[model samples]
Target: MTDPVDRDSRVPALVRLTVDLSALRYNYRRVASVGERTAAVVKANAYGLGAARVVETLRREGCRDFFVATLSEGVLLRAVDREATIFVLSGPVDEESAFAMVRHALTPVLNDATQLQWWRAHRETPAAVHVDTGMHRLGFDYRSFSASIFEGFNVGLVLSHLACADDPPHPMNERQVARFESIRSLFPDAVGSLANSAGALSGMASGMTRAGIALYGGNPFVTRPNPMATVAVLESRVIALRTVAAGEPIGYAATYTTAQETRVAVLGVGYADGFPRGATRDARVAYGASRLPVVGRVSMDLLHVDASTVGREIALGDWVEIFGHTIGIDEAAAWSGTISYELLTRLGGRVARCYTGS
Candidate 1:
């Protein structure tokens, strides 16, 4: 008997995720151009696009600073680029993690007093301080903030997160900037970073911008047109085709009934592949310029698309793009009732990631 894994590798993948490294580099330059300096946020495995490749691609484009959400992520990234400054956003929860940060040369973003204490006790290298401006998610509270708390610490960076950076007109952006500025002044010698993806795009970044989703081609602004290039293209193969008569229900739960004769194409991708099941509502897949509406419920391993409009143009084994240059990721994410961040990060492991334009 042959090995199942080897046999599977011999065949073509049903689902393909093509990452455009050139486009990713383009996006980094575009975002970095808006601020004094920018750091790449490669957390969540670079938003499920693969961190190792994204880090290498960005490093070639002159990016030296990187950020991750956890100590393990920082360690993994440190292994990729030994010299790049990697900041752990979640900070150290205990003495062992702090020691690991020092061993890996990973800087911890001290979030609270306890984390600060941990870093101070195991202090071997400089650490960043995250001052809570308004997000209230992480970091030290700016309301009762005092520079004395970090009196003898070698604070390399002081940063804050913007809650409403996506909405340029939101007042919170202004308030956060003002508060962050006050706190940043305390660590005058340290680098000040107040911008995330949206903030950096909108020119709200201070000394150093932490670019996250925008680096992967996600739109930073909420209402404005996306200025970044498309970096990831998700495609799936058509495995089967069928014709449904009028009044015939299609797929599980019998949600969609054909009013007229319809041509259906079964795609080899489903919710299990990170194509959200909720996207069954007003979702679509594209073949060139033709858009095919997704009907009925999305299964764990399969989905049905109404391909009648294309007639016989689409055939078995034909590749249909789930989202890419033709169909924007943001638009497809909206159909799933989620954001691009969630959609990108939720990509299942079975999908083969192919890199191009390196």
Candidate 2:
């Protein structure tokens, strides 16, 4: 079937997202290596990489449990694998969605009394109960917590989210753990879970650990070495090249000026392509072993990078790695003062995705 990851560099894709499934699987094992029952969070289109393809790869690696944020995500996942455990993290809203959850055998992670009541009305399968730890985003609080809330339904998992799992020493981590432990203890029959990607590695997660961003090559530890292999590679084609003399202005409103005579490579990607409008630090692109600085304001469809350092070997249509095996997403995200998850999810649909290392 002509491999979907078009290895041919000649193909004219302005921007390409190379998803290394091998690295993804390796990352899965890396997170799983900590010995916690691991569940894959394949929400947000598997963090903007094609969920179907990524899930297919993970399934082969023996990942049977998956988590999604909404009914639509659960529905799409149900199409991918029928027997795998699919938990709708967002739970159900209306009667229709609750019924849809039952009909598909998809489990809902009940967050509040309304959702709990809604799921109970159409309970055909087991569901997860989310307890609020510290994020205050979803899950039940002390006011909502009651044995009667789960009285009649089958509770499969009792879980909570950590507001500061990325920062290991944060006091909120211990607080969430204590709260989550207390809630999980109330349900002896269901599996207890309180760790996310970072939680799993921290060795504090109980029962089952749910992994999200780390499974996709993101380093959950903000200040530590990324233990996982690089999984995502973003590359853009060099469509145009030019020479700008010293003090010459580049890009919109002359946001950047050339320090000396500089060669510029204008790539076919921009904020519209999920390249981060200006989140990049030093505004550089990778060429061979050299780093080319971005010399202008990032535009909607294009961005200019100074190639005077390695302009001799560069050519039109040659692919330049933006964030890849050599460049970590966290590193790039740091330059932009954002997290890897945001950069990964914010990646626009304009960029073509090609899976490799399957």
Candidates in order have lDDT scores of 0.89, 0.84
TM value for model 2:
0.95
The runs of at least 3 residues in candidate 1 whose Cα sits more than 4 Å from the true structure, single-residue gaps closed, are 1-10
Residue pairs clashing, model 1: none
Worst 10 residues of 1 by lDDT: 1-10
The per-residue C-alpha lDDT of model 1 at residue 153 equals 88
Model 2 gets an lDDT of 0.84
Q: Candidate 2 — which residues are off by over 4 angstroms? A: 1-11
TM-score for each candidate, following the candidate numbering: 0.96, 0.95
Write one digit per residue (lDDT tens) for candidate 1, span 1-358: 1111122446698888889999999999998888888899988889988898899999899999999999888877877788999999999999999999999999999999999888887554799999999898999999999989888888989999999999999999899999999888888799999988888888787799999888888888889999899999999999999999999999899988998999999999988989998874688899989988999999999999999999999999999999998999999999988889998899887788888998
- The clash tally of candidate 2 reads 2
